[model samples]
Target: MLHLDASSSSNSKAISDTCNIDLNSIIKIETQLQDNPYDMISLVFLLYDVPDTALQRLIVYQRVMSDVSETNINLLQEWYCHASSRPNWQHELLEALMICQLNSIVKSLGFHIPTMRVFYLSSDPFGSKYINPVKKILYHACENIDSTNLKKLKKSLLSYDINVMEHTTCEIIFLELMSKKFITINISQENKTDEGIMYNVENIVNILDKLNGLKKIVNSLRYLQSKPNHDTIKLKQDNTNYGVDDFNDLFDLINQIMPNTLENDD
Candidate 1:
């Protein structure tokens, strides 16, 4: 019988984690695709990490277009011909092509605007990294908008019977959204005849809530993509932070979530 200590167990887990997709294999497949643009086999292997349904749709679109028009076929041929030799191929042309295809599919399927927005955000490789802060702010603002504290502040203003400008509400929302640590809203009242009352409201929004919102959005997009029927899809409303998720984790998650998408043809 073998006995394992805590340290040894941890080491074993680390070793198991190393079995993810090989970076060298990705590079080799990319090179092979560039060398032979007409190789559908290599193309499929290169797109091994994408969702199965998305890959199937692309294949079906390609087959349909091939039979539809000579001009369209020539255009695709030219596109791949250019892609094969293009420098910085993955980041530059590959992303653009994926976005174009996603856009066309969204339009053809008549996906609602909200669904379109979610897909568009997911398609952006830099979205999670760049938009995290903004998402967090918006999430927190939504959570705090009608809080009892905020309502009390509003009641205090109404008791003073001061006329608040429409711009004042906009300013309050803006301050709430832009706040990092705490938001302070101040207004000054001169007299009973004064049109505006003066007061300051301070509020704190949870950073964790914002991070959780971002995770929910990313996960929702993944769920939407995996479903066969877009008409029945519904975004989850939970605000649980899924972990300290990042772009690298997102890529790995996608690969893990759709493992059957990458089965090598026999």
Candidate 2:
């Protein structure tokens, strides 16, 4: 149904050809599922892919879940397990597909689905380290201002698998949506104190400085880790020493900044 036409190079033709086959396979699989909702073999086969089948596979699963009654829960669970055991990209795609389908089902059925429970029970691992591909789907789904559901979804997102940049992007989108629908936080100017103001400013500056240092360390570590086959033992030892030094410096800085507080505590 969706055509991918990118005429950048010779490989474009090959990709298009593969996509055509993928489309046909998706159609056949959908028809089989519709005819026999219990067809686990066809469902499992859908998890397999060739080059350029990402979009095709996503479309097929979307169509399949558009009509929830056509899906077999047990078979879907098995398919999730199969997908999770594959590469990270495949796992991310499966997560996005599941979120899309669950949103559709919720809208159609006018009820909330326990997506978190389903994910946990299916043993589909999620965390902040993994990237989320369905952020837009999630953003739109929560636009209805169902506070209860939104709260639950927010908690679930803690384990919803997103990288640092994606997490920031999603938070911005969420804040924008909430701004449009709800009142912003209000603080009275009369309640401000000079001591409190100074403390808050110092805290903010300290946090920013620490974050800048941490970012540098993370970038350096990423570069070093990516270098092919270097002395791994030496690298590990160097990193361990680097981390210990950073922690010591951090603690010393904290002690210097809050010496009076530490004395009072003692």
After superposition, the stretches of candidate 1 with alpha carbons farther than 4 Å from their true spots are 1-128, 132-138, 147-150, 155-172, 176-251, 259-266
Candidate 1, residues 113-149, lDDT tens digits: the string is 2322332346533242122222222233334344444
Q: Write candidate 2's Cα lDDT for 173-255 as tens digits.
A: 23332233221212223433221111011211222223322333233223322331222112221223332232233233333
TM-score winner: 1
Instruction: Write down the lDDT of every candidate, Cα atoms only.
Output: 0.30, 0.30
The Cα RMSD of model 1 versus the native structure comes to 21.1
